[model samples]
Target chain A: MSEELAAVEETARRRGSRPIVWLAWFLLAFFFVNLAGIVFSAVVDSFGDNWFGNWLPQVWTTHYWSDAWHAYDLGQVLQVTLIVSVAVVIVSVLVGVPASYALARRNFPFKHAIMLVFLLPVMVPPIAYGIPLATAMYKFNTITHVQIANSMFGVILANLVPAIPFVVLTMTPFIEQIDPKVESAARMCGASTRKIFTRILLPLLVPGVLAASILVLVRTVGMFELTYLTAGTDSETLVVKLFDSISGAGIRAPQQSDAMAVLYMGMMLVLLVIALRFVNPTQLVTRVAEERDA
Target chain B: MTVAPPAPAPARRHRPPDPRAHLSHRLAERGIDRTLWLLLPGVVFLVALFIYPLAYGLGLSFQPLKSTDPLYNYKQFFTDHLQRDTIGTTLRISLPAALVNVIASVPIAYRMRGRMRGKRFITTMLVIPITLGTVLTADGMLKFFDPAGGWFNKTLFALHIRTPDQPVLLINNYWGVVISLIISGFPFAFLLILSYLSGIDPSLDAAASTLGASPRRRFWQITFPLLAPGLAITFCLTFVLAFSVFPSAYLVGNPTSTTRVISIAAYEARSVETNDSKASTIALIMAVIELLVISVVLFGRGRLYRGSTGGKG
Candidate 1:
């Protein structure tokens, strides 16, 4: 009996290591699959005529990169994307930070409702709202004496609609996490609400604000549907530009398209890393888990 | 999502007076100051630009498409092909995609949940793909899945399958869209859910384990119930994001075989057909379907729609 028990124990302990090995192998497969997908696309783009057929691009060259650098002319779209993303972040922060403060510290009526409205912006599909948004932009041209439909500002305003809710969603918790006693302490010491908000509360909440801002920036830069609808080809976004380049007026341009795709991925990867440093995806992921495990 | 928050009532004191109220209350008690209300500019901005545009779009559904037509744009929309498909297609894509994404993402999300080894690397990799917009990822998929210089071709030929002449897999069809949605959509949704997963009270988990429940049982009885609401919200949000597929279809799809989301139809109705009212109707129809899905998510699963805001202090 003792010998048999020892064998069971050994097998159980030994069995544990195999599953771990299997798991490691599986994860490696996922990584390989995804990485191969990306690199495969990148490597294939370096060739011509052999886009989908060649085992290896019979002719590989860095010509796509050198040639691509000059022609895509992304300066304008980059500027527009930057301006809109930054503007949305600033505007969302300015608006969301204060509201989150009020929501957090104050015992207000309709608290749930307000938050719902705050979240409502992102609740439905952006495209669903975009049709009317396109029209609204057209109408705003007459009323504001600004051509919002085809301009960057219109896109920014549109961006804010989806972006602000995210800010409120993220920052609300950060503000709530800070003890109200601290806010009260500031008040007792003669800090105005504004002073308290700016000096004490704001400092404590920078991480949350930064998270919200970075997320807004990333989403803003990647925005495609609204821009496609609101902004014409004349004021096309990089995504739209990429789309046009591949599927525009002529036959498909795979090499150029892949190069542009690489360019897009590169820019976004840089932004995401920068954004992730301040606004770790952990917090967002945590929120998901909490909601699911609610 | 079900009910709006009640109006903010006056803050009440517990033991008569909390010391700080006197310094601030008297001056501020009489109706909210306009300046104090400035916190609302963002709200108003959304209302005006986002909400207003959506409302304007919705209202147009009641009006006829043509000056001579006497019916609501909505009535005609449902009667028509493009608008009819708007709801059907939106639901078709969102429901199944949400299901597939949720299913496919679970093992990955679960593996990513705890302090497992390789968790960080897996997470970083999962997340990296999403940083690029749908357009970029969809476009890159072409080279990866394309027929000529595509990666799928290269790999298969290397493996001694059929020649590289035909190499398209789910690159630009319905399956392609589904694949694209899964790759781009799941990480965002998974990350959202992972945060909630980590937030499950450890006490509840501990107590369940102490009761002699198996891991699967504990998860279903204790963990999964708690997760349902968060999952619902995540599902709806992701469904919203995914069904509104625009850039992907525009970038990689074959005009006939590859692409045709409702948004594309709306764009076509406006740009190609020169029918703005029809476009608005299509948009409204899409909104209605999405709203219905959200409602089902909120109501069917015995879950409450609480914002992921509050506490953790």
Candidate 2:
């Protein structure tokens, strides 16, 4: 019995020290350390002056933030971003909610095909379609004398393609969760169709609408390729302007770009936290990918 | 007697007949057929914005300038070394980075599955890089992995891993862009894998262990087979995400020819060279490649699980 107990203890010890387990822990630790290190470096460098050849900055200053703010015309950029984001959200909801209701409540021909049509915009990379879209916008602008290209309206329109689809897909699921009988009951009470939608359906769907809008807000703020391709001089959003400053062919201070990046990061962090509170990351990913499947 | 008359005959019956309710009643009598009209605006928006642009782009790709040859732009893309190399460059960075991210996420996700302390917190932290977007991540990489005065080099120097003058070449090359892709791509891959792993029933592993199977044996026989489909899906999604990398490659990479992804080529062809035809050609080619990769992954996934009886050996 004593010999058996000793052998079991030895096996347990060996298993605990297995190389694979150690490697797993080590890699996890490395991942966290690297993640923390990179974020910290950016934050520190944004505030540092002359941070070369040293482990830490010799002097810290808020001058880089000011420089990035003024040099990038961030005030205008923020206003444009706000306008574009809000416009995209409002339009997406207006177009998406009704469509979502139809998709959820009605059985139509080529319903699956229509859902797939919505899926294409989200699945494909923006750059693939953005080039031609931008070209078309320019052509449209030239012909119609309506500044679609290189203008705020153009950016908002371009964003609406994916935003509307996203709203439709997310809202379809929400609409499906609600009982259809509620609308029927309102109709039975001699209420009009519009009244049923406004009083009975809208109140119940508000939470879903809010969640969808918040998500669209996050996506619109982070969208780069389409906006970059279509935006004009005065319509550049924060991401586009940041890209221009960084990739532009000129000698600029690294700290200033770092500061701008920090600002972008801060904004995204706030938006994402609010988003995560309302939706699960896993659920969001699967929803975006498998909505058609669902 | 006056109360009995109640004035109802005059006022209640003739109160405009409630047009709102009347209209609603008429609509209800028509059934839900009008719901198709609700779908009109969205369908029109997609067709106008999404389908039209893609179709126009495809059409534009075939029309070459100064030549009637429909394949002129495509032939040029294949023959030109700089343009042709973007495909190779994109694959080289995307494939390995995506593989590493998906494979690395497996063990960590396996360990993280089920009830655990700080799981929510750790998962939230993992998602930060993804939300930070590629531009910010590339900027962070530029600062943290700087060759001259960066902390990574300084730390290596302090630890006697290299001479003070000879810091490791981390940025401005293939590895730099790969690291940035990994940074942004890993969070997405990790979250995906975590969700996949959580879907797997833990009782299978527990049953195997009770039957005297070691942890490795249980994972290989029970867990891995079940996880293969999710892994393939995760790999494909991450591969697509990495394959489309543009800003990060330009920022942290030697963007001249070494890291000129297809998107960069498309951008230049349209913006710099004013050649919309060639730009469309490159974009179409990129789309084709992505579709082929996705199909191959799906095919492999179908094959892997076809013979198994619901993941049973």
Candidate 3:
């Protein structure tokens, strides 16, 4: 009876471990197919008149590489996207840092109420915010010098809603982490108010601020929703070019568009990895995941 | 407890005066001036960017496009060209996708708990969609999931010798959108759960295991109960994310009036028809509904984690 029981327990342990095996398989399946598709796209585009066909043919060339450059509006799209991203980062930090600290520190009345005010940008999706932001900008003729629609500025303005939240969220933890005792020490030394901030607090906040800025850059530059709505016909971003090309030709040259897509992906991935060095990426994803597991 | 003992005074100094001494002592005790100075930039930034935007947005909502007393953009949105259908569509797509994402995320998250083989690789793969930009993923799906030249139909035909002309799975339809949602939405939920999983007290789990409970029973009794709050948060986040589903749908979802959600409707109102007031009203309406939903869920999640060792006692 003891021997039989030992065997049964061993069998149960094996059964318990099966889910991990299955998950490994499931992830592999998803990744492999996409990998294959990319390779097939590369090889087939080289060989045949059927531009986006399933298989390779006898005749092949590097036509798509050149085509990818011009088929999509690669040159202009990247410029607009980079410009919008930089602007959003500047504005978000300008807006979010002070707001986040006030919420994190301070004991004024309506304190919680003040924090609640910032949550609107976070709760509502860009789709919802984009309409009013874009429309309001349009009313003033300030969208872009390049005919407003499809311009870089529109995307930057619309992106502010989400980017501001990113700043507030990231800055809250860092600001709240400051040791209050240090500030008290400065006071006892007879330091003037301006002297204390300029000399003390600002220096300490450098790492925190750098972390916040990189975070804002990575997401804001890559943002898509508001850009799609507000950008002019001629001012395609990297995403717009990618979307137009693979889905079939728009003004973006199709063959060259693939190269732009690959380049965009490469740039974004590099930035994300760099950002990860500054801040924890898991903080964004696992806020809820951690809750479920705990 | 940690404060320094009072400093030694100058040797020749006389005893301090009463009122001046009293007033100086109080200011020194509270350190209010020093604290405010440290907090200035953050305070100024919040007031200008966050508070201003929200107040302005609210004001914009009430303002009318035309003349005088609270004009009728709200009225215009109600009457506009098939514009009213947007809310219904956005919620229909958003709600289902969010729910699906939250549910699918659990299994992957469970597998990821405590670090097993290939875990980092799996996590990276899951987050690829997020980094790749929503547009690229949707575009990739468009290239691969189409009926004729796409991967799904092509694969099925190769394996089973089925009809090649049959519709491809997950392209322009609601499922396509859900696939995108699951791909992008799952990583954050999975990571959040994974962190929470790591934080859970192993002793409680050990106690449950010793009590003759099976693994599944232990999870339900010990893990799931504690995890309820986290689940609620994940649901709200995933819902908000899917709620704003535009680029993926617009880029990949074949632009039928059927898939065009409220964002598209609001966009058309302002851009296509040139009506800022109505668009503002519509956007405000969206903000109100989403905010209301988020508050109800967040408040109901029981409590924020209170025992964490991050703060001063």
Best by the lDDT measure: 2
In model 2, what lDDT does residue A10 have? 42
Lowest-sum lDDT 10-residue window in model 2 chain A: A285-294
Q: lDDT tens digits, residues A66-148, model 3?
A: 67655555667667777777887888787777666666666655556655555566767776766655554564466343444
DockQ (Cα-based) for each candidate:
0.45, 0.37, 0.32
- For residues B31-149, write the lDDT of model 3, one tens digit per residue: 33344453455445445444554456567767776755574666666676566677777788878777766666666665566546777666665565667766666656666676776
Better of 2 and 3 by lDDT: 2
Who is ahead in lDDT, 1 or 2? Answer: 2
Error of 2 at A119 (Å): 1.4
In order, the Cα lDDT scores of the candidates are 0.68, 0.83, 0.64
Q: Give the number of the best model, judged by DockQ.
A: 1
Whichever of 1 and 2 has more TM-score, that candidate is: 2
- Show model 3 residue runs off by greater than 4 Å: A1-52, A56-73, A94-102, A142-158, A181-207, A228-237, A240-253, A279-281, A284-294, B1-81, B303-313
Docking class of 1: acceptable
User: lDDT value for candidate 2?
Assistant: 0.83
TM-score of 3: 0.78
Residue A25 error for model 3, in Å? 5.3
